[model samples]
Target: MTQALRFRLATPQDAVAIIACVRAVRGEHYPIRLLYAPEELAQAIAYARLVFALALLPSTGEVAGLAALEPSPYGRTGEMGVMMVLPTHRRRHVADDLRLLLVAWARQHGRRGLWGEVLAPVADSPDAACVSQRFTENAQLVPSGIALGLWPGPGGERQSFVRYARPLPAKASSKACRLPTRHRALVSEILGRLNCPVSFTADSPASGAGILDAKHEEGLRSWVLAVPRIGSDSAAELAGAIRRIQTHPDVAYAHLELPLAQPGASALCELAEARGFFFSTVTAEPFHDGPGLRLQWLAQPIEPNGLLLLNPLARRIAGHQSREQERVRPWAVAAAA
Candidate 1:
C-alpha cells in the first residue's frame, strides 16, 4: 500500500480500533457480531481464533485497513475475510498488503487453502455486487464453489455467495475415494486440479445406519448437512432433514456433503440430486470429511451468469451445476410454468 502505513498482526489492545473501523461502514449491520463487542473481539485475538492483519498509519498509529482469517475447527483450511479498506485507503494496495499477510499466516499454520465467500467489501450494504469476487481473484484465489441463496441480503432477498479458495503449495492429498458412477468425471477433474491422489474400489453398500453432522450458521441461515459415514439409512434420514430445512422460512440454503470413499455415498448423491441438490464443491480435507463431494440446494434460482466465476474450470463447474439443477428439479420448472 502507501508508504504511510505499516502492517502487522493485531493484538488484543487493538480490538476497539477494529470495531470502530467496522462500524464506520456497517454500523450494526456487520454479520461479524464479535467485531462490535470489544471484549469478545479482544478474546478472539488473544485466543488466536480470529487472526487479523492490520494496517496502520505509521506516523499516527491509526488503523487504516484490516483482513482476518478464521481457522476451521475441522482443520486444514481457514476462512479469510472481514476485508475492509477505508474509502481513503482503497487504491493504495492496503487491501492487497493485508491479504498477503493473512495468506502467509495461513501457510505458517499448515493450512492447505484460504476460503471466503463473495460479498460486498462493506457489509450489509444494499449493493451486493461482484466486486468481492474480483478482490479475491486479485489475491490469487479462484472460485471454488457457489453458495446459492446463502444469506438474507438487502430488500429481503437471499444472497448467492460464491465460494473462493487459494490453494497453498502442498503435496498431493493421498485420499482413497470411492467414485460415484454419475459424478466420477467431475470429481476426477477436481481431484486432478488439487493434485489429489485417489484410489477406488468396487462400490459396496453400507451395512450400518449413516451418521450425520449437522450445523446451522445462524447469521447466514445456511445449513451444512454432512454425511461423513454413509449407510443404507442415510438417504432416508438425510431426505427428512433436507425437507425440514427447506420448509423453514428462514432457511435459504442446504449444503449436502458425502464422502467419496463411502460406498452408499453414490446412492445418496442420486437421492439428494432427486431432491434438487446440485454440485457446489469437491474437497479433500479440513473443508469437509474429505476427500468428498458437496452439493447445494437454494430457495432462489441463480440468475443467468449470476456468479462471476473467475477461472475457466470454475465457470465450467458452474455451468454444469446450472444444467444439473434443472435436470434434478424438473418439477420446479413445471410448477413455475
Candidate 2:
C-alpha cells in the first residue's frame, strides 16, 4: 500500500532519518558532493535553518520518503534539496506532494520564488531523470534554462540541470531602482572613458558602483563608484574587491558579479543567500559594455552576491508579490480550491 506523506520543520533529532534518506537517494540527481561532506552533516543541519522536511509515514511516524527546504541567499528565497522517494515509494506522487508543501511554505514565509536543479545519475538507469521529469512537470516548473558542466566519465560527460519556478498566488514584490546621490559624474566619466557597458551594479542610494582598478581608486574615488572588477574576470575581480572592502574601513557593504543564465544566476543567488545579503532588484536587457559593444546583464550584483533576484523569472515573482501586498495586506492568504 502507498504510504501517507507528511511535512514538518526538521529538528536535530531528525538527523539520523535525514542522513539515511540522503544515502538512499545518493548519486542520482544532485551535485551532492559540492554541498555535503561526511563531516559537514552537522553543517547541513545548521545551514538548513529555514528548512522544512517532507517524509512519508509507513504507519504512525516512520519515514519512507523525504525532501528538504533549505535557505537561499536572495532574501526570502529558498532551495529544494535532496528530494528522495525510496524504491517502494516510487510512482506514488510523493515527490509532487512534498514540492507542493514546500511551495506553500515559501508562499507563506515571504519567499519570492523557488529554484531547483536536477542532475542525472551515473548509472545507465533512466529512472533518475524519469522521476525528476515527472516532478517538474507536476509542479509546473518550466524548463526555462539549463546549466552544463563537465564531470568525470567518457567524452567528458556534461551534466544537465533544469530550472523550475513557482510564483505565489499572493503579492511577491521585488525592489526598485534607488538612484544614487553620490558619484554619478565620476562613474559617468569612467563609463564614458572606458566606454563601459552593462548595468553591472545594483541600484545604489548614492551613485551606483563602478569598475575601477587600483589606480582608479587611488585617483578619482571622490564619489561612490560601484566598481565591476579590479582585475579581469568576474571571480577574480569579486574576490579582490571583497578583500579590499574588508580592509578599506571606508567602504560599506560589498558588490556583485552575476552570470546571466538561469542556472548561473541561481547559483550566484544561492551564494548571496549564504552571505546574508538581501536581494534588491534585477537590472537586465542589453547592457553597455564598451564604446560599441554591449552584453546582456548575465549576472551583476549590487552587493557581492547580495540579496537581489537577478533572474528574470524570480524578479518577476518578487515584483508581483510586492505589488499585490501593496494593494492589500502582504500576508493575506488566498482561498483554497
Candidate 3:
C-alpha cells in the first residue's frame, strides 16, 4: 500500500526518529558522529535561529526523512543541513519534498537564499547530482587537510564538500563594495551570476573596535572566525587571530567572515590576503545589520579538477581558484624558502 507523506516542523519528540532516519540514510557513507545526538537534536529543534523539519509517513506514522535550516553568517541567507531520507523511501522523492518544504519555510521567513554543503567525492555522485538538480552550485570547498570526523566516507575517509545555493524570490539592488583590483573582473562576473550588484570602493584604513569570535568544530577540525566589527586596531587583532589559528595542531581550514558594510573592508581584505587568505565569495549580510564578505585559508592542498560543478559560474569560480592558487604559488614558495 502507498503511504501518504506529510511534512511538519520537528518537535522534541521527533528527535529519536530523526536520528534513526539519519543513521539509516547516511550511516554507510558518513556515519552519524556526535553532532546529531538526541540532546543536540532537541536543542536544534528549539533553537530560535534553526528550523528543523521531518517528513512523516502518515499511514504508518513513521518519520521517513529529516532536514534543518540554520541561519548563515549572512542574515538573509540560511544553510540547509541534516538532510536525510530512509532507504525504503529512496524512490519516493521524500528528500525533494522535504527540501521544498524547507524552501517554503525560508521564503516565508524573508530569507533571500538557502545553501547546502554536501559531501561530493566526484561531481556526478548521487549526492552531488541531487544538489545540482535542486540547487545551483556556488563553489567547491577543499578539505582542510584534517579528517572531518563527522562526515566519514567509505573506509571512514574524510570527504571534501561542495557548496550549492538556491535563491528565493527576492530582489537585490546593485551596491558598491571594494574588491581586489587583480581579480575584480572575475569577482564581478561571479556576482553577476548571483544577481548581486557591486561597485568597488577605494581602500581605506580600518578603524573602530572590531569584534572577533572563534569557534572550533572538533568534528571537522575546522575553525570559523567571525569579525562583526572593524576598528582602528582591527588589522592587528585579525593578524593575531590568524596566528593563533595556525597554531592549532588539528586545524584543517580556517574561515574569516567580514562585513561588507565596514568602510575599511577592502583594506582588511588586503591584509587578510597578505596573511594567506583567499577570496571565496560575498555572502549576504553577516548579521541582521548588513551584508558581508567571506574568505578562506587552507592548511593543505585541494584538487579542483575533481569538482563536479553544475553551474557555469561555479565552473568559472573554480577556474579562478586554480589561477589564484597559481598566482600565489611563487609568494608561498618564497615565503617557505
Among the numbered candidates, top TM-score falls to 3
Model 2: what TM-score?
A: 0.47
lDDT of 2: 0.40
lDDT per residue for candidate 1 within 1-337, as digits (tens), equals 4558899999999999999889876678875567888998899999888999999888877788989998765547778778888788888888888988988887787777667887522243444455666666676765566666666777877666666666546556566666656566766766665556566566668878778889777667778898867878887899889778777777667788777766776778777777778787776555454576789877666642455555677677777777777776774333223
lDDT per residue, candidate 3, 213-255, as tens digits? 8877766667878877777888888888887776666776677
**Model 2 stretches astray by more than 4 angstroms:** 1-6, 27-39, 56-62, 119-144, 150-156, 168-337
Clashes of each: 0, 36, 9
Scored by CA lDDT, what does every candidate get? Answer: 0.73, 0.40, 0.63
- Judging by TM-score, tell me the better candidate of 1 and 2: 1
Measured against the true structure, the TM-scores of the candidates, in listed sequence, are 0.78, 0.47, 0.82
List, residue by residue over 1-337, the lDDT tens digit for candidate 2. Answer: 5546676656555665666666676643343442234345555566655364557474666556766776543235466765777787788777777777777777777654455665434335455444665666665653322222212234534333334544324432221212222222322332222222223234211122324333122221111213231223433444444344434533323334342211123333332333332222222211122111111111111111111222344334333323322332211111000
User: Could you report the Cα RMSD, in angstroms, for every candidate shown?
Assistant: 4.8, 17.0, 4.6
Better of 1 and 3 by lDDT: 1
Alpha-carbon shift of residue 7 in model 2 (angstroms): 3.9
